[model samples]
Target: MVDRRVHEGEAVIERAVVDGRPVDADARLALDARYGHFTALQVRARRVRGLDLHVERLQSANRELFGAELPRPEVLGAIRAVLGDDLRDASVRVYVVAGDRPRVLATAAPPTEAPTGPWSVTPVVYQRYLAHVKQAYGFQQAHIGRQVARAGFDEALLTTEDGLISEGSITNLGAFDGERLLWPDAPMLHGITMRLMERMDVPQERRPLRAADLPRLGQVFLCNSWGLMPVGRVDDVPLRQDGKLMTRLHEHYDAVSWDPLD
Candidate 1:
């Protein structure tokens, strides 16, 4: 693996290992100029949920961006290098660096923990350049999130010019209408957790959602790799905070099968 071990016990926090070589991240990435596409997922026992989907995501993005093939075998070797031998659990991300010959970069850290949320968010008229690809578009999201924070909000709810709801800066938006789970059908990154939830035993739908519908919804929550969380506030409007529902959602997610890397 890449010699990222640091601290007293020499704990390894593997990240930015490019094509079997340890690279200076600053030089290789060139501040997003060389960055291509990526997929972030929590790996348990060297495996992950929706592993196939994650691979498909990378391959699709590669084809779209570079018209090249990102073989899973090549990616697997890079990821295995990052994980080493016996890692129980970690948060991992595989990135493709665009160039004459695309390179693979694998990043790993202690599994990402859930953020304490009942988040306060504000709606902003913004859309990602390539919303579908999990790429280096964090700069725009961070910018909007900071502006929302200045207004006493924890997150930014992205919307269209005409007030059609899309998604959060970093999470998928879901609404519980006292019966069914409603997901916004607007242009946004279709997250793995959201896709998994759709396959699970939950009353859900994908439909066009407007910003005005938040008030009409019984409860609103955010879903992502971290977990499900209640949306306590949408701008000045306070939505229902159902801890029980959140717990039930987590239970459902926990029941989903974990895919082994081997």
Candidate 2:
């Protein structure tokens, strides 16, 4: 769902280069204050579906990560202000790294579309220390994206260190294990979009998933703040492509109502 205009803006910025040896400490502090303390900030394009939900999640994560309430940083408001009329359907990403000051970036782009077929994914074994926080720690995601593109697949599905499928690079993972929809049950991160579906009475189980269990799956999908996107293929294994179950769940998710619980 990324807007064409925003993509163009990114390209323009990506090509630009500044000529300088970098700034001094005071200058750096001033810069960091602009973005806040977190390494990154993300607001779903479609999943949370509203501004209040995004703010709530940010505050919650801030409290959990820093042991203090969020300062109501202007980053969120800046996002809304900058995107103004241009934003209708889009996700926003803000990266704020700690240094002399914080570096903040904001991008409002379209949401991801549902996949067209079954999927194959390789899970990352280790977990990022701050899995509970939705910062810019996207190195694994970038690696998985490259791997998927090289292997001719759609995306990367990640499993927790304990062998349970936790989530995708940018989405949460859900699979049917003959009886119910199984989601990783552990001290893993809870996604805003995933929580919405759960609030809608979508039956899900929290359990450990093993490599040996892949064959038993009746269906598989990736869910995130954007929405649930069906997997079309996995590694070398392929599942049914019509994606009836996934499609229905997706449609139901779209029509259902919601209120943020966090």
Residues 1-262, model 2: lDDT tens digits = 2222321222222111011122344553344334232311223432335345456666666566445454445545445543454444444554344444333344444543444434556656656556777654345556666666566655555666567666666567777544467776654567766765665445677777655565567776666654676654566666544356776677767775542212
- The CA lDDT of each predicted structure is 0.75, 0.52
Candidate 1 residue 219 Cα shift, in angstroms, is: 2.1
Off by over 4 Å in 2: 1-51, 66-68, 71-76, 94-105, 110-112, 160-162, 177-179, 240-242, 257-262
TM accuracy, model 2 = 0.69
Candidate number of the best lDDT: 1
Give me the overall lDDT of model 1: 0.75
Best-fitting candidate, measured by TM-score? Answer: 1
